[model samples]
Target: MAQSQPAQKYGPDLSVKLICPECQIPNPNVVEEFSSGDLVCGDCGLVLGDKVVDTRSEWRTFANDEGDDPSRVGAASNPLLDGVDEFETMISSRDGNSGISKELQRAAAKSSHGRSERSLMNAFRDISSMADQISLPRSIADIAKQLYKRVDEERLLRGKSTDAIIAACIFIACRQAGVPRTFKEVWGLTRVPKKVIGQCFKVLERAFGSNSPSMTPGVDTPTLNNVQSGPEDLMARYCNHLSLPVWLQSGAVDVAIAAREHGVLAGRSPITVAATCIYFSSALFGYPKSASEIGNIAGVGDSTIKSAYKILFNEKQPVLASIHDKRANVRNLPDP
Candidate 1:
């Protein structure tokens, strides 16, 4: 027997040109009556169409505007995750006495939530927790979670250590947020080795399509660069850590900026540069902090601070001269 072709029933053509029957106007301005689902003519009241779909958001509210929406169907969707709703079917253990609970758990696992989705969910939770542990703001947590999602989706670091990836994401997120933290700071929170985090950071840098490309290892990669923080950015934080006055921070930042512009602080890391500036700035302000104290806060050794100070001493003339507005008096600044 030959297969019969299915008969096609003609339906109303929505795209067909509409005109007001009373006024005989072509393509008349049609207004939608959402309450009755009728499209009426704008110039003259005429029902051009009926039963049109309403395409507005389903936002319900209580008596208070946008508050306590009891009739709302579901909670807001997370911008970071893929699930339409975060309402997972969780099964209670019930003191390990209920077999039904285990059965429910297995059933829930087999439902819409797959292994990969669960992994992503766990990763996002961990990212938020880690951010909270370090007292980082919610914004940083969101950004890190986004980076983790991107790396996983793009397979940019396939077969790589998830811990390392998370650590790198945290580090990158901090730099991108303009609160540039040292790898040492990130390393303290995440026991992942600095070498591994650094490697992962490089891989992520390639993922960006050519914005903020300079990847100098020890330099302060600017905001959105996801590199390291510069000495200038670290000045206020270090000053606060050391209980130094505000003037000291301002002076130290100027020194770092001058050293950066003159290209004299190339070989030193940002931490070392920052430490040296604080030390020099402290001396100028008559509140000198011991090298060991500044080194302790900046996460560098005392010897490293001394070496940076020696280098600064050699280039002291231009570094001081380049300060904007002559903030630092050449006579007040001391020899390293």
Candidate 2:
């Protein structure tokens, strides 16, 4: 069947030209005489529905209160296709861009918070105050700072308590700094609850690993002559006894010293003192004897030796040279 003819709709007059507010393009679908008042722009998507407006003539007035909304009035007055449109778009674009830029800046600021010097100083201050509050040794407090840096870099500490963090830092610093001390000794100085140091250290270790990558095995000038041996030293000596490299053997000695120092001066645990001494000796001197042998020499146990060695791996360099050399020939050693 053939389709019936449809009636024409009201539209703009053909003589009238309407421009799209958004694109500012001339409207092509405007009818010279229309049934309805609406006029749609063919070039752009702008739809003009007001019949009161002339189809053939240019419009200066707005559909609603043009002065009320600057954004809408601005767009209508200056279409996107014209120079006016460019200005309006630039303004609108700035609004969106500003919001995105603000969000990015906020994120960057948050990320940099932990890295700022202020943040580090704050952390140091907090730790120092905590040490004083708990009555931990000054050496232990200093060591704690080092450990805190390591932990912060590792991203393992998520706002843990100052007490917990201090204990962990102390334990790690003692081992690394060659300060052998016991949990009891630690408690005496820190005034923290028993085992808190060990427990928090375990958490830190599990999160950041039991060992640190930057740990060096050597003693400094001041600490070179300290013969306090810990299990770590015994372990180093044990490695040495097995014909380990000279560096390794020497490192074992440093580790032993660090462990021992931690126990005696830092941690203040006699049990750790003997154990650390034995372990370091075993590791550094190539002593093939088990922990039992070295522990016996130090008047401790095999378990203590093992535990002290475990602590030693995180120890820092103790003496740059052997104690015998430092005592005999101060000038003989190379300048650091």
Q: Least lDDT summed over 10 consecutive residues: which range in candidate 2?
A: 80-89
Clashing pairs in 1: 220-230
- Candidate 1: which stretches are off by over 4 Å? 1-75, 87-111, 209-228, 261-263, 321-336
Write down the TM-score of every candidate.
0.66, 0.29
Put down candidate 2 lDDT per residue, 249-318, tens digits, no spaces: 5544454464444543356354554445434544344443466765554445677656655554444234
**Quick one: best TM-score, which candidate?**
1
Report each candidate's C-alpha RMSD, comma-separated, in the order given: 16.2, 24.8
**lDDT per residue, candidate 1, 1-336, as tens digits?**
999999999999889877788878765787899889999998888887899899877775566665644555666677667643455456788946858888887787777767777788888888888888777888778778877888888898987788789888888878776776777887777777788888898888767524432233465435454345788888888899899878768888888888888987698878888898898878766787899999888889999888788888888888777764666343465655
lDDT assessment of candidate 2: 0.51
| Whole-model Cα lDDT of every candidate shown, in order | 0.78, 0.51
- Per-candidate clashes come to 1, 67
